[model samples]
Target: MSSSAVGHVISLGCRLNLAESETIRTLIASNDVVVINSCAVTNEAVRQTRKAIRRARRERPAAQLVVTGCAAQMDPAGFTAMPEVDRVVGNAEKLLPASWTSHAPALVQDIMAVRQTAPHLAASFSAHARAFVEVQNGCDHRCTFCAIPFGRGNSRSVPAGAVVDRIAALVDAGHREIVLTGVDLTSYGPDLPGAPTLGLLIERILTRTKVERLRLSSLDGIEIDDRLFALLTQEQRMLPHVHLSLQAGDDLILKRMKRRHSRGQSVALVERLKRARPEIAIGADIIAGFPTEAEAHAANTRALIDDCDIVHAHIFPYSPRAGTPAARMPQLPPATITARAAALRASAARRRAAWLDAQRGTVQRVLVERPGDRGHAGNFAEVRLPPHEVGTIATVKIERAQDGKLIGMPA
Candidate 1:
């Protein structure tokens, strides 16, 4: 196995996991160990985690493999049983430097007992232009299909002052954009003093920090507070793009999944956002075939793509996670799940293509994430442009749309 001063981090799962991985990388200095930040969002995710562990073992035969994150936290014994895994660390222990050097084979802790989020700051992100700061951790909601709460524990938040200070520091370090990430992002401050909301936190960041562009990770539509709604309309630094956590579009499926929002409420929220900001881009996460989902429910979910004008959609064919309530319900056939997911993805493709086409000849402010190859516009559309500095925010006049990306030249 090859060795370097810095350990390698293989991150899986959501943006929150990515942010945590950055902190883990900063904490660990060993060269002979590879950290696997695993996810257990679905059965497929666990399979992928196992595959990554095996592949890493094959490539680096002599390296010590440390498994951590949601998957390892949920089932430490399962990961410890794997021959490739030298040790299993829980989510709470993974960020600490001491845990990396400990001899314990399993360092899992009671995540539910964890009350405060540690303020782990990353000086820089590897191969990325923007910085992600974790504002909150864990979830308070118990959506039946989700096992994340068990792995992550109850909701906890970093203080608003710490978040502002971190963003200011990242900006000073030449990071132009900052993304605030969390397990349940909108559920940010209920546990903190004065119970300040997510909106208040954003307002503080924008007011106190010199961050040029601010983006939010996925948010639940039902939790869009009045302050946040107002900020969406008024704050230009807050990018004009939102990815909503709308798992299913049918009312019955939503009810079955223990989601807070109804089908009509989801549609209404999108309509409201679009009306307030005409240029905003809306994206969503929609499950294809939840257990007991019929053709009628699937059709409603399909129609929701058009109803909500969701240009960027994350369509997942439902895979039951062990111990989730939905897993015990009558399962849908594999064929039905595949077909429904395909249909939803196809619809989303058309919407994305049309959205890209509509950008032709329009001037956009794009944050050049990769010099010469790609960057994302304020509305979150990936744009291809001529070579520019990695962090340069350029004004580009889009020339054409192809392959779901917009080709643009400096304006």
Candidate 2:
């Protein structure tokens, strides 16, 4: 790894996988090799995967093209069959190259025992000097509409000590803000022997490290408990943002989707979060036009979302994958799916506008990730800046909202 060779990583999935790739970037032993983490998380994922391979191969024709992550894990034949890919490893095997340490013994050194990787994201694109740190990988849930179970199996958590060490490194790397990403971050550390919950893991992070701003990627509706919510409420540094995967707002659709939380339960949970973290940017993932979904069911969804105080929404139409149970179920008509998705997208835009309207004339601490004309927005939120450093954090008074960004002037 010390030798000059360009090493690039390709990731194709959710934030958990992306965070894992980030960890790989932090610790790879070669400064000479450029690391590129690619992503593919949809129907276009296969196309993108091929495209990434072609691009990587063209640039580094002699370099080893290691295919890994969900696409590689689930469909090794398809990934390795590509002439560009030299080696095929499952999601777990991809992180191996990053385990190379100077202190590693010559003979007995093996990262197989090192277990889960808790690499803090270093080269974050966040406008603020922030980074993402993966606290865990893999999933235990078997949501009927998902292929993740086929992609990443089981629930194995990173060790508490190792997680703390990675956070220390991230802080040393000048990352003032850190986001913890995982498939089911709420289910963090359950696989460990001592049964350290995410709350316990977070307690360690906040108490042990100097990480300024800490945020979570997404939370499963069923996993939020008093302890974790309490920690977020208590910590000022914990960013006021929670992305809840509200796959469906209708109870019938939710039941079919196999989301553990009932519609009422989800609504109640959102209300609870609103009460505890009022200023929190509560977001949801809505799967519009699910199989067997009626027009009335979708109506209920829009109504529920409207009433939920959800500020941000990412709506995905049911895209049936071959392996998922939903794929075998009565499929939603593609045209219907498209219609519902468009409606939901418009609704989300309205929600964004409403949320931005609420923020006008208020002061928000924005994390300036890039240099504009001058300064930048906080929280990596964009704004015309006084052109400061990429990692600069600035407090700005919001004048208005424009083009999905909170426009502000220096506070």
Candidate 3:
């Protein structure tokens, strides 16, 4: 091992999760040890995390194999069962030191002794030219279909000054783009002494930091509020793309799911945002088959998305998560969920195609991430002139739309 290695998940289920892992990486990088970042989102994810711990143990034979992330947060006990693991901790604030124990026992204690320690707060870009920063850590809203609230606690905001310093550090590291991510990004700054709002936080970054082209991860309808939207409209650095949670369009289903926001509110957010920025690409997430969602609800969702002019949609079929209130909610046969998911997927495909088509001939400043399927683009889209040498930025003119991606030529 390079030093004292600690492991974390590499690939994650969402962009927010990816950002969180990068935060964890920066924390341990300064300690001068081999930090094993994981890339296992599938069943292989568990295998890889476990394997890395074993390898690290073999190399050091005494280094601490501290595990964290969705997999570890979701299944700490399972991961601790691995003989290589010296310490077992949940998603709590305390950094459980393996020195306290030879092997982790049944982690039954709350460990309330650990105050919320922000891990370094120094953000690092997982890629070449851009970094992902987190301004919030946990979630307060509970959608029936998600287990994030269990892994991550109630909404907790990162201090605004810390965020500003982190942004400056990222900029100093030569990153041109920064995507602010969190469990609830809108909830940022409430826990701080001054309690400056997310608006002020962004204002600080824009006015103070030199980082270019700031983007945001997933957002909720109610969180946008009025002031944030106004800032979004005015800010050139803030990306035009937004992925808001629009789980379903039916009001009754939304109530049952405990989404706490009405479809009208989501629609209004879209309308105001589009009015403010006409070319803005709006994206949404839809649960094709919620526990008690009706056929009409699905239809309503499709209609709502179409009306909102959403450029893209991510369709989920309501996976049953363990230890969540939704797991015990109700029933829908697997085949039906699958069929509805397929239908929604078809709609999303068309939605993306139409959006890209509208952008044809318009120039977009594209940040070319890693390579992808065929000769297609990576992370963000439309990289013209060959499969891109990652870390370079190029202006691309939307030439055509194909297979949910924007195919483009050099502008």
Candidate 4:
């Protein structure tokens, strides 16, 4: 329950949403208000958003409740119907200062009609050690199970100059790491003049800015361009951890989900990445028990975790959204979906444990985010060490792995 002169902002969903909430915090000016930056990635996400809104109302009874983000953008009337909500702002409208006025009611516009991304500049992030710069926004692809495209409009990118300048500013502010985030990160720059690639953007940032560590958010494996692949192999500042948007591992399921890459293609891409950089760590977002998923299909996805040497996996049990194509497909039983999700998680836990064990005795560069013993290593693995200066990157000699984190001392 952090407070400002205006209000408290509660963020949900991806890092992109969290970045937006930071901007929202700077816009409004009423202490008696509470704004919920929501998520609509899954049905469960919507439920959680609603739960947060209600809880906020109970805690701050007099605070005016404002609902915004993908969930609100997708279904404005639904949130406006809530008795606790006083206003509903869309994804596009939430950034505007006018929408924060007490007079504003529901400011949702046609998201599909939006073509250009208006840059939201922030000098710093809420976290001290790292900051996120939004290089792109919206998604062009229409995955059958995703509602994000409708929540966010067609693909638009922030100009390269603006991005480089922002990175330089964050670096000057003493941030040790900078993360480039977007709705569809790899699709960056196609809409801009000359249609420069994301690789070109990265090159410009590295050359023009004094950024120490640069990381990218989730990316589609099929979109890894040749130039980007080269940079990954050659660049030391580019972090060696990649979290892929590989929703399912079976070819048939992937086709049904309208994913661009095939099972073989995904595996091949991971192989190439590992070959280029042996120290690289792989992670993925996998949906368990997707529509029409069988035991064999689930098994293929589970097998892919080991095949790709994926150490971190985000396992989602399929939840039908209101308007997605998958929601209209033949649905699996609740029990079946739950059981398969559990199995996938259990398999992922074993793989993660093995990967952690392998890190023992290895020296790692950890960027400390907390005062005591918490931070993330270069591979994005959570690590615990002796007290170190916050916002400083320290070298640690890994000695043990426990409770999903690596334990180490200063090297």
**lDDT of residue 23 for candidate 1:** 86
lDDT of each: 0.90, 0.70, 0.66, 0.89
Residue 174 alpha-carbon offset, candidate 2, angstroms: 1.4
List ranges where model 2 is wrong by over 4 Å.
1-5, 10-12, 26-41, 58-63, 98-128, 371-384
Per-residue lDDT over 246-341 for candidate 2, one digit per residue giving the tens place of the 0 to 100 score: 888899999998888888888888788778777777778888888999999988788766777676787887787667888889877899999998
TM-score of each: 0.98, 0.86, 0.81, 0.97
Write candidate 3's Cα lDDT for 66-96 as tens digits: 6555556667677667787655545452233
lDDT of candidate 4 over 1-411, digit per residue (tens): 643334788999998898788778878745578999999998899999999999998887777899999999999999999999999999988888888874677999999898887658565775557887888999989999998999999999999998888888889888879888999999999899999999999999999999999988999988999999888777999999988999998999999999999999999999999999998999899998899998999999999889988898999999998788999999999899999999989989999999999999999999998664789998999999988888989899999999999998989
Candidate 4 RMSD computed on C-alpha atoms after optimal superposition onto the true structure: 1.5
Quick one: ranking by TM-score, best first?
1, 4, 2, 3
Candidate 1 on 1-411: residue-level lDDT in tens? 344424888999998889888888888766577889999988899999999999888877777889999999999999999999999999999888899879899999999999889778677885678888999999998888999998999999999999988898889989998899999999999899999999999999999988999999999989998899988877999999999999988999999999999999999999999999988899999999999999999999999998999998999899988888999999999999999999999999988888889989999999888654689999999999988889879999999998889999989
Candidate with more favorable, higher TM-score: 2 or 3: 2
Give model 2's TM-score versus the native structure.
0.86
Worst 10 residues of 2 by lDDT: 102-111
Model 3 lDDT at residue 298: 72
Q: Which candidate gets the maximum TM-score versus the true structure?
A: 1
Best candidate according to lDDT: 1
**Candidate 4 whole-model C-alpha lDDT, 0 to 1:** 0.89
Off by over 4 Å in 1: 1-6
Query: Who is ahead in TM-score, 1 or 4?
Result: 1
